[model samples]
Target: MGLVGEVLLLPFAPVRGSAWVIGQVLNEAERLYYDPATVRAELAALEEELTSGAIDEEEFDRREDELLDRLEIGLARPAPEN
Candidate 1:
């Protein structure tokens, strides 16, 4: 039954392939987002931008808060299986 459905959808294979690729990209992006090291690197970069006056106080505060929130959520979640 599943094989028949795949055969029927074969003509739209490229579309399905594109969707699969997009899903993979999204998954990787999410994993990277919750990564502690990545979050720390972003925090350091944010601080650098703020100190260099690349970003104003308001922008820095908002982004800093967002990053901190991510950190908190990531830490609270159970560790993922390797």
Candidate 2:
């Protein structure tokens, strides 16, 4: 953009910065959410919960399915570039 265009958009710089920050945070959050290690840990915890009767069989099944789905999706994603 030219100097004139930049000057015109100067007032919106804060808004643009905030949007970029939000996008970064969202991307990081999704990366963590779909991380295989994290999902596996959650699955192990869920199994412990079931064994202790902290959760019923139905709840265990539902949560296990969700965790497996996350693991599958995470595995399917291409590795990030260095």
Candidate 3:
């Protein structure tokens, strides 16, 4: 953009910056949420909860299915470039 264009858009700079920041935060959150290692850890914890009777078979099965789905999806994702 030319100097004139930049100047004209100056008033909206804050809104643009906020949007960029929100996008970055969302990307990072998704990366973490779909991480295989993180999902595996959660699965292990869930198993422990079941063994300890902290959760019943019904609850364990529901949560385990969700974690397994997450693991499958995470594994299917293409690795991110550094």
1 versus 2: better lDDT goes to: 2
- Pairs that clash in candidate 3: none
lDDT of 3 by residue, 1-82 (tens): 8999999999999999999999999988998899999999999999999999999999999999999999999999989789
Candidate 2 C-alpha error for residue 21, in Å: 0.4
TM-score for each of the candidates:
0.70, 0.95, 0.92
Model 2 lDDT, full chain set = 0.96
Q: Which pairs of residues clash in candidate 1, taking residues 3 or more apart in a chain or in different chains?
A: none
Model 1 stretches astray by more than 4 angstroms = 77-82
Q: Sorted on TM-score, highest at the top, how do the candidates line up?
A: 2, 3, 1
lDDT of 1 by residue, 1-82 (tens): 6999989989999998999999989978887898888888999999999999999999999999999989887788678777
Error of 3 at 51 (Å): 0.3
Q: For residues 1-82, write the lDDT of model 2, one tens digit per residue.
A: 7999999999999999999999999988999999999999999999999999999999999999999999999999887766
Candidate 3 has a TM-score of 0.92
Which residue segments of model 2 deviate by more than 4 Å? none
In candidate 2, where is summed lDDT lowest over 10 consecutive residues? Answer: 73-82
